[model samples]
Target: MRLGLVLSEAGSGLRRNFSMVVSIVLVTFVSLTFVGVAALMQLQIGQMKGFWYDKAQVAVYLCNDAVQNSNCPSAATTDEIAAVKTALSSAPVKTFVKSFRFEDHQLAYTNFKKQFKGNPVADYVTPDILNEAFWVNLNDPNQSAVISEAISGMPGVDAVTDQRRLLDQIFAVLNTASITAATIAALMLVAAALLISTTIRLSAFSRRREIGIMRLVGASNRFIQTPFILEGVLASLIGSVLAAAATIGIVQFFIQGYLQTAQRDINFVTISEAIVVVPILIGAGVVLAAVSANVAISRYLRV
Candidate 1:
């Protein structure tokens, strides 16, 4: 009987402040949508980093000269190449250094020409002018900086380059976008919380006479409070469900079909993963609304 009465009161309160309830729901829905997108984007960033970084390589170019004590050489002798390989294979860096090899000018030029065969630039350039290079693969690319620094000053080494810088720039852009979405979401969430508080306060004031009468009739604080809290929670839950539905539709239509087809090489997260985030967002909204309503009602019901 107590629970029934509390629920009836909550429903009546929501019905009385329909406009305010709608506003709260819409605000939460919009806010949580952005929050969900940011979360998914962050997850994508992690996935991309995992996929690409593991395949990243550190290229150590060798000098082409024999007598050139300078890192740059006209040609590298057999002994010099052997010494370079031996040093790379024998230390702390050696554990993760999976393979290392010297590529002569001819072989490097062949690869260079092969890659640009269809390009207009290919007509203006030929393989003969390209420099010889050394390709090195590491077991863990994260340890590449250590290897790069170690071999940079070594004899017969021309230059050391790692692919990680490119990956960093790519991931940085995605992270920025994700952060921006999260910021927008947070702002909207604050606005929604304030709106909910205001709405609940208004509802409590309108019901002031009824509440006073109920208290006079021996109604407990819990009885009076439970209904308001439930009203706020219901509003938030509706918003969460709306946001989740919107996210599902957007992912299914915009992301899975349109964006994926347009950017064939880029992989986006599956719709199923996106749907999973909805519950979490909804839970957050419910908690925010409940707390805000509780705080707003406390001052009004102090009598």
Candidate 2:
């Protein structure tokens, strides 16, 4: 009986301030949607990083006739190559290198031909011009720097390139995008909270006479505030549902339907991942609205 009466009062308040209720709903919807997108973007970035980092290798390229650095005035001799191999097999550097394979000029040339097959550039390239390289796989990708520092500027080495460097640049762009979405979501959430507070204040203002009557009848503050808080919770709940639906649609259509097919190499966030975000959005919306409403109503009742 008590619950029914409180719900009835809440419904009446919602009806009295229909426009404000709608504003809260819309604001909550957009804010939660951004929250969901930012979460999924972060998940996607993590997945990409894990997938790429595992495959990344450090390529230590040796000097050849076509390339001349101050450290390598001429092509690397057989003894210079032997010394590089010994250095890789020796202390400090060897600890980081899980395994190393030397790719000779012939193998490099073959790989280049296969990569640029049927291209005019392939016709002009020769095996002798290609640099020999030690492709080093690391037990931990983060240790690539250790290997590079040890091998770079050596007698026969031209450059020590860690594939992770390129991957870092790509992930940096993705991190920036995720942060932008999160910032927008935070601003929208603040707007939603303010809207909820305003709506509750308006509802309380319209029912000041009723509130005075309840007060005179010895009704508790809890009883007076319950209906108003329920009004905010219900409105925000509706918005959260819409945001969840929108989040699901994005994972289904945009990520799975388009991005997966378009970029087959990349792994995207799935529906299951977005489903995890739905409850979080709903909980956040409900809590924010409830708190905002409670504070707003408490201030109004005190006056």
Which predicted model would earn the best lDDT?
2
Off by over 4 Å in 2: 77-79, 90-95, 104-131
Cα distance off (Å), candidate 1, residue 212:
2.6
Q: Candidate 1 local accuracy as lDDT?
A: 0.82
lDDT of 2 by residue, 1-303 (tens): 399999999999999999899998999999999999999999999999999999899998899888786877988889989988998999877878889899999999999998898999899999999999999899999888888888888888899999999999999999999999999999999999999999899899999999999999999999999999999999999999999999999999999999999988888899988899999999999999999999999999999
Looking at candidate 1, the ten consecutive residues that score lowest on lDDT are 64-73
Clashing residue pairs in candidate 1 (N, C-alpha, C atoms within 3 angstroms): 64-74, 64-75, 64-76, 65-73, 65-74, 65-75
| TM-score of each model, in listed order | 0.80, 0.87
Q: Rate the local accuracy (lDDT) of all candidates.
A: 0.82, 0.93
Clashing pairs in 2: none
| Tens digits of lDDT, candidate 1, 1-303 | 377888899999999999989998899999988888888888778867887887788887777543354556466567767777787888776887888777777788777778777888767754445556667788877788877777887766777899899889988898999999999999999998899899988898899899899899998877888899899999999999888888777778888889888967667777878878888888989999999989888867874
Best by TM-score: 2
